[model samples]
Target: MNIKGKTILITGGGSGIGLESAKQFLAEGANVIITGRNSAKLEAAKKLLPSLIIIKSDVENEEDAIALLDKVTSLGGIDILYNNAGVGSPALNLGIANDQILKNAVYEMNVNYFGVIRLNNLFINMLKSRKEAAIINTTSILSLVPALEEPTYAPTKTALSFYTRTLRKNLEILKSNVKVFELLPPVVATEMTANRNDKKITPEQLVKALVSGIKKDQFTIRVGDTKLLYVVSRFFPKLAFNLVNPKKIYASLK
Candidate 1:
């Protein structure tokens, strides 16, 4: 799809991938609106890219999601709805309190899974009105291969991957012009993992891959080593599991 002249709304656009994606979209001549829970971060993003339209809205809140949709639609209908907001908890063990796990689980599911569904349901028909439009749901490589460091986070992304696949198939069955794209990125150099020393792709690299993928109509856009993860998971499931699970290292030390 030609990204130029399209109106795009990206969630969690205050930082990392979202922020970089928004910047690139603006460069591509698209109108971009970014939403996030933190007003300060959103303000900072706006300062960096004065063309950006920032809305402080938490995806975890139904009210905020609804208000965001209305506000963006009023500005101009959205051609791309990029569901990119997500959260992660520290690696957990079964010994953690059940109540605490449950609490974190609920919040993660609400933001990562249910929130994407809600926005898509709210804006799908509006998207159809445009000549060409897309809904980009940000899942992760973890959705394909479980990551030991993010047990809770991985499951939520996996659920989102499932939902995005179904949504794409359903849209095709309806012969709709609305396209659904799933973005699966491996660990990237972002604020979320600033202290981590692992090899990671830059946000600029991700945005470049994403834009090229979209232009060519690649529905499942896997960035960086995520493509490797998909391959390993398909043919070497056990090896893939061991690679991502740090617990395997402990077992090796013994």
Candidate 2:
């Protein structure tokens, strides 16, 4: 929970929430190492934050994940592994038969869910060895209520949300010191959501809330509209569904 003096590795840290996270964590006095698939983006991020340790790697690749672990281990290990990399395919109607539907679902699941598991499995032992360590998984508000517009993307987060919760309980039962934290963020103004006109929080605002939550040792940190959605979904499932998948979204799809 102590950000100061701890080293953290964040995936997909070239821009958006990940980059903002690197900035805030650095300001908090933590050593930050960032990884992304784009070499140019990594270089740009390094230029922005001269102290950041940038590595070019893709979360979906097994070889890349292994190499990343070796590289991080050589750098003296990390106290936190922040899984922030995620992807979504273009909006498509799942009611119609289309090959893209399955393809999109697989791609989202690979990066958003399995990728987190791969990295966590590789680093769990190292994290346990640390005096204090944590694993942060970024799920979405859609994980609580599915969005019709983001059919595949929403399901991926839902699966990850379940995995994260189970993983936390499993670690606790084993008496492990490694802390698992699930961050459920609402729509944020990022490259991924650039096309959306929906209201969004800035990356800075989201990361500020995240860091504050981590410092307070809050495992499930819900930000912005996510907090409200959680409460509503618990009591009013039908209304929560309507809030996420409005009538306009259905009309647009049609």
Candidate 3:
């Protein structure tokens, strides 16, 4: 897709991958607008990129989704709706039955999966009207192989991964102009993964790869370790599972 001269709206744009995406997209000559639930973080992002149009909105809220759509429409709409907002609950052992396990799963699903659907539904029409438009959904490598430490978080991404594919195929069947792109990223060094000692990629590297993939029309953009995991899981499923949930991670869970 031609990102230059197009307008893009990114969710959770205050920091991490979203912020890096905004910077890269803007540098690529696209008009950028960012949304987040934190007002202070939004302001901080605005300060970092003076040209960014920052809006405070939570992806998990239905009302906020509507308001965000209205606001984006008023700003002349967007050529790309990047559903990048996601959340994960603290690690908990799924083997031990606990009420908190269900709560955490619901929270993760609400933000990581349902929130993407809500925003996509609201903006589908607008995207279809555009000459060239796309929806970018960020699913994770964990979707391919479950992580022992991220029991609840992994399933959310897996659900979203399925949804993204189905949505893309549905759009294709309808011959819709709105394109769907799924981004599968490895563990990135971000606030969300700050506590982890896992090998990580910087947000800059990930977003750079994402932008390159978008330009090349790569619908399923898998970055870094994600690319390897995809291949490994295809053939050596057991090895791929072991790679993600290593002995160390399993021990940590206990």
Candidate 4:
């Protein structure tokens, strides 16, 4: 919970929320390591933050995950694992071949779901041994309220949300000090939403809220409109579903 003096690892830290989080945690006196597949972006992050230990690694690759553990172990194990690496589903067209759809879905799951599973399995024990530690998974509000636009992407988050909840409960039963936290962020102005003119919080704003939430020991850190979306989905599932999938409603209205 305490960010100071902690060793933190943030996947997909090359940009967006992950980059901002790495910088914020570094400001709080934490040893931060950021990993991504893009060497150019990682290099740029190093130039920008200078203090960040940037690693050119892909979470979808098991070998890269192992290499990442080795890299972090050399710097004294990680106290916080931020599972932030994720991919938005490719544009889904019903006209596309079924094989292509399946292929796209597999890649998305590999990075979004299996990546979290692998890293958690690898470093959970090390974190448990530490006095204070946390596993933060960056899910989305779409997990609670599915969006019509992201058919493939939304399901992955939904699955991860449940996985994180079940993991938290299991940790509690074992009386483990390692905390599990889910970061459900609303639409942010990132590469994931480059063209869309939707309302979005800046990555810095989300990171600020995230740090404050973590400090308060909030297990579910909902950023911006996500907090409202979560509540609506909880109390009014049907309404929430309709609200998020307005395009679907319109298509059916005729």
Candidate 5:
């Protein structure tokens, strides 16, 4: 599907991959509206790219998601919905248990899983109206290969990946105009991992892959270690499990 002249809405566009992807879409001549929970961050993103349309919002709340859909549709029916909004908790990966895990789990599921489900339903009608409608869901390499460092984040992403695959097949059976897409991104240099020292791909690199995938009408677009994870998860599940197994380094959180 051609991205030019399309109206796209991207969740969590205030920073990292979403921000960069919005930049690329804007460059391609698409009307881009970005939503984030923080007004300052959204404003900063707007300052970085004055061409971008910023909406202060969060995907965790049903009301906020509904309002966002209405606001963007008024400008134009969203030709593409990029469901990339996600967040995780510090306790999720550190072998933490009990109350901490429970508290964090709520946000993780709220943003990672429910976020996509809500957006898909909210924008389904408008997306169907478009000549070429697409929905890009963001997953992670960990979703395929689990890691102790971030367990909650990965499971939610894995669930999302699972949902996207089935959703794609279901849509094809129904012969719907809306396309389901997933991006399994590996370690990227973003605020999401500001403290990490791993040498990962830049935001620009990921954005390029995203645009290319969208142009070619691909369903799953993965890059960097995620590509490796995809291959490993398919070809060598045993070895992949051993590589980043959570049980190994999980020092129980007191």
Candidate 6:
């Protein structure tokens, strides 16, 4: 899928990865629409990237997703739907209390899973009608391997990975032109994980890899340590799993 002149809807556009994606897409001359729950954040994005179409939305809410898709598609045909909106919560292995663990799991699932689901469902038809359409889902290294924070985030990515795959399979069954893609990005120097020194890749490097994978030919856009996770997840599930356990391996959050 060509990024130039294409219209793309992005969720979680307030800050971090989502915001960065919006800026990069705009620079590439793609018609970008960004969504977030905070009006202030949306306004801030607008201030920073005036070319962007900003929408205040909570992708976790089904109705909000439907409304957002409707609003954007009505303006013009949608060529790409980048489901970049996501949340990361502490995993049960992080050893938080039971109540916090439950809340964390739910929060992560709501933003990471259902948020993408709602957008995919609503805009799929519109994208199908277009000449060429694509979907880019934001997954993580934990989806393929366990991280100390895996319990909170890995399941959501695992679920999302399956969801994207099934959708692609269904598209084949229906003979649809929509191509699906995923990113297994390693930790980046973003606000969500700025403290980490283990990861050397910058968001620009990751985003560059992302744009390179925007074409339909790309499937899994794995970069940096993320690829290692797949290898580890496959060859040494238990050993790989233990490495990220906060209790057993490293309790240090930073």
Name the candidate that leads on lDDT: 2
Model 2, which residues run further than 4 Å from truth? Answer: none
**What TM-score would you give candidate 1 relative to the actual structure?**
0.95
TM-score, each model?
A: 0.95, 0.99, 0.98, 0.94, 0.93, 0.90
Candidate 6: residue 151 lDDT (0-100)? 70
- Candidate 5, residues 1-254, lDDT tens digits: the string is 79999988999999899999999999999989999998998999999999888888889999998888888867766799999888977745344346777767778998999989998988888888877898899988888887666767778988998999998998899899888888888788998788766668998999899899989998899888777767888999988887655454555433
Task: Point out where model 5 deviates above 4 Å.
Answer: 91-97, 245-254
Each candidate's lDDT (Cα)? Answer: 0.89, 0.96, 0.95, 0.89, 0.85, 0.80
Error at 123, model 2, angstroms = 0.5
lDDT by residue for model 2 (1-254), tens: 89999999999999999999999999999999999999999999999999999999999999999999999999999999999999998888888899999999999999999999999999999999999999999999999998888999999999999999999999999999999999999999999999998999999999999999999999999999999999999999999999998788887776
Which of 4 and 5 is ahead in lDDT? 4
Candidate 3 lDDT score at position 66 = 98
**Which lDDT tens digits does candidate 6 get at residues 33-100?**
88888899889989999988888889888878778767886788678888988777643545545677
Which stretches of candidate 3 lie above 4 Å from their native place? none
Clash pairs, candidate 6, are 91-152, 148-244
Give the alpha carbon lDDT tens digit for every residue of 164-202 in model 1.
999999999999999989999888999887866678899
* lDDT over C-alpha atoms for residue 149 of model 3: 84
Which candidate order results from sorting by TM-score in descending order?
2, 3, 1, 4, 5, 6
lDDT of 1: 0.89
lDDT of 2 at 13: 99
Which residue pairs does candidate 2 place in steric collision?
none
Residue ranges of candidate 4 with Cα displaced over 4 Å: 93-97, 248-254
Clashing pairs in 5: none
- How many steric overlaps does candidate 2 have? 0
Q: lDDT (0-100) at residue 232 of candidate 4?
A: 89
For model 2, the run of ten residues with the poorest summed lDDT: 245-254
